[model samples]
Target: MLNRKFGYVFLLALLASSAAVGAEYKGPLDVPAKVNTKFAQSNRLTAVAKAGNALVAVGPRGHILVSENSGQSWEQVPVPVSSDLVAVRFVNATHGWAVGHDGVVLHTADAGKSWVKQLDGKQAAAVAEKSFKKAVAEGSEQAKKSQDLVTRFVEEGADKPFLDVLFLNEKEGFVVGAFNNAFRTQDGGKTWEPLFWQIDNPQSYHLYALATHAGELYAAGERGLLLHWDRQRQYFSAITSPYQGSFFGLLDTGKELIAYGLRGNVYATADGAKTWRKIDTPAPDSVVGGALLGAHYALVTVGGRILLNKSDGSGFDVIPASSPMQYASVAAASDHSLVAAGARGVRVETIRDQAIQEK
Candidate 1:
């Protein structure tokens, strides 16, 4: 059985990397992605996001596809690295970032047409080590523990992968990944500072998703780990999690925040994480990704299920897909249709009453 906490691509990549342990090989991090003319028809896309009116989806082998006509057609772009990109986010129409295996981060200034590599696992580990060492020298209370963690990071080398990326705007953003790896960039992707010591994750749980609700930055990950950025304290503080299972994604419904993950567990909070209410879902499959439509919300599951709810986070109903396939992430397009990225590829579907009609 697949682990509900990690995405299918993520787990597969980890296993593949492990199997190649001592082999002298050139990894995805060093190689550039090969351009495929049939990428739109064949690539296994994992996540989708809206870059203004354009829809962008990313997947294995650094495949980044962009569609301007609401997912009607797509064009594969050039990327520097072949690392399997897991998640992508655009602050606006022109600036975006994608993160994936090998802790790779790619930036695009011309929307999704072109991209350049930024921080990767090797650089991330070094940054964390330096930051932690400085903190320890300053005699900060948590510095010693953080230093120890970074020491391990340095020893382990560049095998970690970043699962998600979030940009508050063109200048500020964060990238999070496995083993509590995270970094923040103030001047876009120019430079990044390690956030290992800034987050309160002592167990080093893998962070799967990042979301912002009402000006607060939140991260959700393995074993129900949920954290919100505390500007006053200068670090992320843990929220009281409602479930013990892992959370794969977070959705901000304007009126409430929803955290959904393992075994179809979904919880909503309208009071800023102070308390949570269990929301009933139709299937027990993990809810992997979701998007907020105009007045409704659409959530997709790994079992190829779609859950729709109102903006207030109520009236949950299952919107069956015409051809069910495992989904990783979803985004609302300009035509009000849902663009889903999953095992098969990027799929365009529309919701009519309670059924999703594929386009």
Candidate 2:
């Protein structure tokens, strides 16, 4: 009987190990129909912003897809290099920056008419080191991790070192990433400075989201590592997060801030970071990212769930978007017209027209 018990235990252990390996292959299982296509097999979507009457979405392997007349139609912009793009912010209808892999930063002055490579992180660090005010590797955890990302994976069909960027305007912005990498630029794309010298455990921290709310910069990363900017010193400091999973992105609802993370991890704070509480999500899969639609509505976007939204009193309702969004991401205009970005370098525009009145 004892031997029988031991055998059962051994089998269970093996099964558990297998499950962990499978979990890392996390994917959008029930992707909406619209984003599923051969050309748009994008993995990590980093940048989605509105430009003029167009919506631009940028992502891995130098993928830039522009949607003219909202997100109803898309066209690919052939980038000069095969770099992974992670984030896009438009200061106005014309000026913007898209940041991504290999320390790459792209800028467009003539709208989407042209793009120029502004600065690479590796190159920026070298330049910063020559300056008298070069900030020494802060010896913080972030600095240590930044060094570990010197080499990146280029596995075919796999997502590589992902990043996130935010711009208060075309000239001043910051881009952050996995391996504790962070860069700041004040003169648009003229030059950049490393926020921290290195990040500890270099490759351990996978940053997924960044946003500025109420004059404070907030960053969220793997295992729920949250950081806030200290304006006086111009650096980031660690803060307590409610979960241990990676935060894909954040939703600023004005009255509340929702810090959404892996596997349905969504935490809300009413009085800023003084306190946080988890909100229940209807979906069971890990949420990769999301954004606000309007004053009383939000989209619970993940890589797989094309469009999930929470109406004022109706709770969570899937968006009526026709396209099946796979490996999806979501953003919203101030007017609440929803724009989703993701793999295949794709973007979709949607709006809540009306709901059917049931008998």
Candidate 3:
């Protein structure tokens, strides 16, 4: 089993070695009649979303590639700039947002037929300046020690660095990140208001994943932390988990919910996220993200491999794929069709028409 804990040497070996060009895989895959060979080497697969019959993959430096008719043929949609897009979410075909490093955020209202930059990296410039001014004000022995603190804020975004985003609808959504960065939007992402709590020497913790189910929101990240805000608490409660890995992706299977993390950490809950059960899998490939298709099924990116893990109402099987995913993430169509994608711009398809137990 590939369950690489952060401190486990075996997990480290798996993470470092799994992405090598020659990882062997004997899983199900689609051999395109005419594949887009150029995308096979891309390290830009950050997130995947199902759009119509098309599977849209987003990645670093403004790379957006789409495949219609279930990944048989793909064409690049001309992106406006070369910004490193870390994650994307489509509410429908259009009206979605992608967030990434820096304060970069992009929006597409036309089903990614086109996109426009909504936020820029400039917002973070204030973080560096504020640290500098504070350090200068304490120019003594304390100020000398403050130098390290200031550098931390300047370099590591201890002041403000956002991680994941969740839009409940086009009108209402939320974003959380480092330095206690939290914001809520009520006007379809048109505007946002900060949700901050003052602290002495605030630090940074990147919000790794955000999910919504049954009128509640959940966000989890580093230190085996899980936070849920619902009708009562409306604030995050620190929930403990069995593992210490960062939970990166979540799926609301309606019947049951699945939350996964680095390496092969999966926690499943039948009555929502109330109680979770652990499941074994192959390789701890840091499944950074996922997409739920239909019910009881999803497409997930593990380590750097894509697996169409299936749920027959109660349990899930990591239905194999044909090859090692060049990238680390994948998405499904609205119909649960698997589209594995990754770096070097690689993409492979597995439609519902394909059997899960394929030899």
Clashing residue pairs in all predictions, respectively, total: 0, 28, 25
Q: For residues 88-152, could you state the per-residue lDDT of candidate 3 as single tens digits?
A: 77777667777665555667777666666655434343443453465467563433544554454
RMSD of 2: 12.0
Using lDDT as the measure, name the better of candidate 1 and candidate 3.
Answer: 1
* lDDT at residue 109 of model 3 (Cα atoms): 78
TM-score of each: 0.89, 0.73, 0.70
Sort order, lDDT high to low:
1, 2, 3
Score each candidate by Cα lDDT: 0.86, 0.62, 0.59
Error of 2 at 219 (Å): 0.7
- Candidate 1 displacement at residue 241 in angstroms: 0.9
**What TM-score does model 1 achieve against the real structure?**
0.89
Of the two candidates 2 and 3, the one with more favorable lDDT, higher being better, is 2
Candidates ranked, most accurate by TM-score first: 1, 2, 3
The TM-score leader among the candidates is: 1
Quote the lDDT for 231 in model 1: 83
The Cα error of candidate 2 at residue 241, in Å, is: 1.2
